[model samples]
Target: MLNTPVTIIQPSDGWRSLDLRELWDRRELLYFFAWRDLKVRYKQTLFGVLWAVAGPLASMVVFTFVFDKMAGLPSDGLPGPIFYLSGLVIWRYFANALSAASNSLVGNQTILTKVYFPRLIIPLSSCITGFADFFVALGVMLVLMAYYGILPGIAMLLLPFLLLLTMASALGAGLFFASLNVKYRDVGYILPFLLQLWMFCTIIVPYSEVAQRGGAWRFVYGLNPMGGVVEAFRWCLLRGAMTGPGNANATWILLGTGVPVALFILAAGLLYFKRLEKMFADIV
Candidate 1:
C-alpha cells in the first residue's frame, strides 16, 4: 500500500483576501478574543470598571460645566448634562474604538507572527470590546434619565439601530486605521490629533442647538458623521424640552450619506490592509 499526501491552501502572506464568512466560522474564537480583551481592560485597574464609566461621564461633566454654562450653549432646552452625555456616549465609543483598533495590529505582533487567524479580526475584536463597555454606560444613562425627569419616546425602541450605527462607524474606520498603521507608524501619532479635531466636529461637549445658532456652524456641522447620531439621541430622549425639536431631516440625510461612506471606507481599508499585511511581520 502507498501512502498519499494531502495538500492545503494557506492564507497568502498578504491581508487582501479577508474572508468575512471564514471569520464568522471562527465565531467561537472571536467571542473568546472579545471576552479576553474585556477582561484585560479591567483586570488590574484601581477603579476597574469605573474607569470605563468615568471616561465618558467625566467628559460629559466638563462639557456640561463649560460648554453649557460658560459658553451658554443650549441643549435644545433639555438638561445640558443629559443631552451632552447622550451624544458623548456615541462619540466616545467611536473615538475610543477607532484609536484602539488602529494600534491593535502593532500591539499584538506576537500573536500575528505565531498564529494564523484573520488579521482583521484583531482590530475588530478591539472595537467590540468598546461595545461591551457601552452597556455599562447605558446603565449610567438610565440613572441620568431618571434624575432629569425625562421620559424616552417610542423612538427609544430604536436604540438598537443607533447602537449598530455607532458600531459600524467605528469598525469601518477601525479597519481603515488598523490597516494603515501597519505600514505607517505615523498613523498612531496622528490619531489623537485627528480625534481632537473629531471631538470639536461632533457636538459632544455641547448639543446641536448651540451649533445651529452659530449661523455658519450649522452648515459646517453637517459634515460630521455623529451629527445625525446626536440628533437622534435628542429626539429619542429630549422631546419634552421647551425648545426641543427632537430629530431633523438633516440628520436623516447625514445617516443616509454616512452609512455608505463608512462602508466604502471600510471596504477600501480592508483591501489596503490585505495588500500591506504581507509585510507586517517582517517590518513590524
Candidate 2:
C-alpha cells in the first residue's frame, strides 16, 4: 500500500493565547527593557532625576496660584501646596504609566516582528518606570509636610492601596488602548487628548469635592477610578478622615468598585489584545 502523504494544518483565527507566563521565560528582556527605559529617560536631561521631582513641585506652585489664589478653592485645611501635590503625584504616575504603556507595543514594532517575549512585559516595564517619579513626589511631599508642620495620621497606611488602584486602573486602560492602537494607529494619536481629559476627571488640580458638587455626579464621578485614589490620598496623608466624624465609607466603597472594574477592563483588554496580535507583523 502506498503511504499517504501527511498534510500539516493550522487554524485561521484572529486570536491566540496571551501567554503571560512567557514573561518569566524572558525576565532578562524585561530587566534590560526596564533599564534601557530608565537610562534613556534621565540620560540627556541636565536635571537628571530632578526632572521627575520638578514636575510635581512645579505643578504644586501652579495649583497654589490657580486654585488656591485665583479660584479661592478651599484646601480643606491642608496646606495648599501639600494638598495639590498629593493629588498631583498620584495623577502624574497614572498619566505617565497609561501614556507610555499604551504605546509600548506599537512603539517597538521591530521587536514584535522579530523575536517574541510576552508583549505585556513591554508595557509593564514601561509602567514600572513611572514609579521613579512617584517616589520623587513622595519625597517632595514629605519635605513639604515637614515645612508645613503637618502630621500624617494612621490613615496614611491606606496610601499603598490607593497607589495599587491607580496602577491597576492605568494598566487596564493602557492594555485596552494598546490593543486598539495596534489595529488603528489613530487611537495612538488621540491617546494624549484622552488622558488629558481623564486628568481633569481625576481632579488633579481641583479637589474631588468640587467635582462632586455639580450635583448627582458624586456617585457617577466615583466611577472614575482615579477619583477614589486622589480622594483617598488626601484622606490618608492629611491626618484626617473624609468627614469630621472620622468615617471613610465613601473612600472604601469607591475603591472597592474601581479596583474590580479596573481588573475587568484588564481581563477584557487581554482578550482583545490576543485577538488582534497575530496581524501586528503584517500591519505594523
Candidate 3:
C-alpha cells in the first residue's frame, strides 16, 4: 500500500523569517484579495467608480475656499485648486489604505479562523484596493495641472517612488494597527479621529508654515512620513513650482528626513505584527 503524504504547518521562528518565498508563490492569492476588495468597495454604490473622482473634486473646492480664500494659506505659488488637489491625491490614498488595512483581519475573521495563507497577505492586499481610487483621482489631478499650465519635468519620473513610499508608510502603520485591532477593537473608533489629525499635519498646510514656528515644530513635521510624500508629490508634478525659492530646500529636507522614518516604521510594524501573528487565530 502506498503511503499518503501529510504536510506539517508551523509558525515562523523569528521576525526576519517572513517566508518571502511563500509570499511570492502565493502572489495570486494577493491578487484575488485585492480584486475582491475593489469589487466590494463599489458593490452597492450608485456612482460606482465616479466616487473616486468626485471625492477629490469636492475636497479641492472646499480646501481652496477654506484655506485659500478664507484663511489665506500659502500654496507656495501654485493655484489653490491644483495645490490642494495634489496633496489630496496622496493623502486620500494613504487614508483609505490605512483605514481598510487596520480592519482587514477583523473583517475577515471567518477566513482567519478557517483557512491558512500568509497572514501578511491580508493587510498587504488591503492596501492595494485604494490604488484604483488613487489612479482615478490622479486623472483629475492631471486635468487640473493642464488647466494651470504646470508641465511636469524630469522630476515626474520620481512619482512612482513617491507612491511606493506612500504605500510603505501606510502598510507599516496599518500593520501595527491591524494587529492591535484584533484584540482591542477600540482602533476602529480611534482610527478615524487619528486620520483627521494626521491629515492636518501633512501637506494640508504648507510645510513652510510649520517651519516658521521654530526648530521643534519643524522636527515634528519632518517625522510625519506623509508630510514629505505630499511635498514630494507637488515637487514631482509641479516641478518645484509649488513652492517659492525659499521653501524649495525645505521640501528636500522633509523628503530626506521622512525616508528613514518611514523605513523605521515599516520595520517596527513588521516586528510587532510578527510577534502577535501567532495569537491571531486563537484570539481573533
TM-score of each: 0.87, 0.87, 0.93
User: Could you tell me which residue pairs clash in candidate 2?
Assistant: none
Taking the tens digit of each residue's C-alpha lDDT, what string does model 1 give over 63-152?
Answer: 899988888866667777887888777777788888888888888989888888777778888888888777888778878988878777
Q: Rank the candidates by TM-score, best first.
A: 3, 2, 1
Worst 10 residues of 3 by lDDT: 239-248
**Candidate 3 TM-score to native:** 0.93
Q: How close is candidate 1 to the true structure, as a TM-score?
A: 0.87
Whose lDDT is greatest here?
Answer: 3
- Residue-level lDDT tens digits of model 2 in 184-280: 8898779889877887667543344544466457667657778777877777787542333223665676667677777776777777767776666
Best by TM-score: 3
Winner on TM-score (1 vs 3):
3
Which regions in candidate 3 have their CA more than 4 angstroms from the true location?
1-16, 246-248
Per-residue lDDT over 76-134 for candidate 3, one digit per residue giving the tens place of the 0 to 100 score: 78889988999999999999999899999999999999998889999999999889999
The lDDT for every candidate, in the order shown, is 0.74, 0.76, 0.88
Q: For candidate 2, give the lDDT of residue 3.
A: 96
| Sort order, lDDT high to low | 3, 2, 1
